[model samples]
Target: MYVFIVALLAFVLITPAHAQVHVDIGIHLPGPPQLVVVPEVRAVQYAPAAPANIFFYSGQYWAFANGGWHVSTGYNGPWIVVTPQVVPRPLLFVPVNYYRIPPG
Candidate 1:
């Protein structure tokens, strides 16, 4: 009984916990902004006139705001924060000048 309890406690202590956090970035766009294809990276398009650094690639909208990356299905977003790894490679390769609000 004692050995089983120790083994159970060890298992509990060694286990990892995973959690999902939902974040709202508060991005409001009046209408879809015109997207210009990135010259260097053809697959990625950017909104040169947007108030925020916005990109479109692979049928999803990506924005750089509030010191992180956010994504949505439409240009005007109920944005959700995502890790840097999940951002598409083409979008990530966009030139720094293309970003309306460049990251610090």
Candidate 2:
């Protein structure tokens, strides 16, 4: 019985917490920045002129800012923080030089 109770307590304590995290990347573009196709990764286009490391692929705008990845449907965004794993594979493979603000 004690073992069962300990197992139950462990299960309760270890239960994963899900929270919606909104990270304000603070990237406010006056207009859509010029997106140039990345030759190394054909499917992903990067904004070379934008102050932040920004990319466009699969109809979503992605930015690397505030030490994290954020995504939105438009250039000026209500950005949502996302894990690196969730970012598209092709976008992840973009060459270092393409990034306006390369991740350290």
Candidate 3:
């Protein structure tokens, strides 16, 4: 009984943080983008399988998800929304098919 209560309390406490990890910009992408190693970041993926995947560039991480764009300083994000015009052009040009994850 004690263990169950502790587990429940832990879940309740952690749920909000877990939820924040995946932000929804209001648009749902059909799928994630392809992983590419762009030069801007040490090794960044252009697109991700999860619509809200993060890409590292310079000293920040960029996210293209839910029809909007956001940027953060770390992989786990407290993302700030940006307009389409602000998004990197190369990311916009990534082929549509790159979002898919290949079958094993």
lDDT of all the models against the reference? Answer: 0.85, 0.88, 0.57
**Candidate 3 TM-score over all chains jointly:** 0.46
Write the residue-wise lDDT of candidate 2 on 1-104 in tens digits.
99999999999888776555665678989999999999999999999999999899999999988788898999988888888888889988998899887788
| Local distance difference test, candidate 1 | 0.85
Q: Tell me each candidate's TM-score.
A: 0.76, 0.78, 0.46
Candidate 1 collision pairs: none
**Model 1 regions more than 4 Å off:** 1-22
Error of 3 at 6 (Å): 58
**Best model number under TM-score:** 2
Per-residue lDDT tens digits for candidate 1, residues 1-104, read 99999999999888776434556666667899899999999999998888888899999999998999988888876677888998888887898999997789
Count of residue pairs whose backbone atoms collide, per candidate: 0, 0, 8
Weakest 10 consecutive residues, lDDT, candidate 3? Answer: 95-104
Q: Report the C-alpha displacement of residue 9, candidate 3, in angstroms.
A: 50
Report each candidate's C-alpha RMSD, comma-separated, in the order given. 4.5, 4.5, 11.9
TM-score of structure candidate 1: 0.76
Candidate with top lDDT is 2
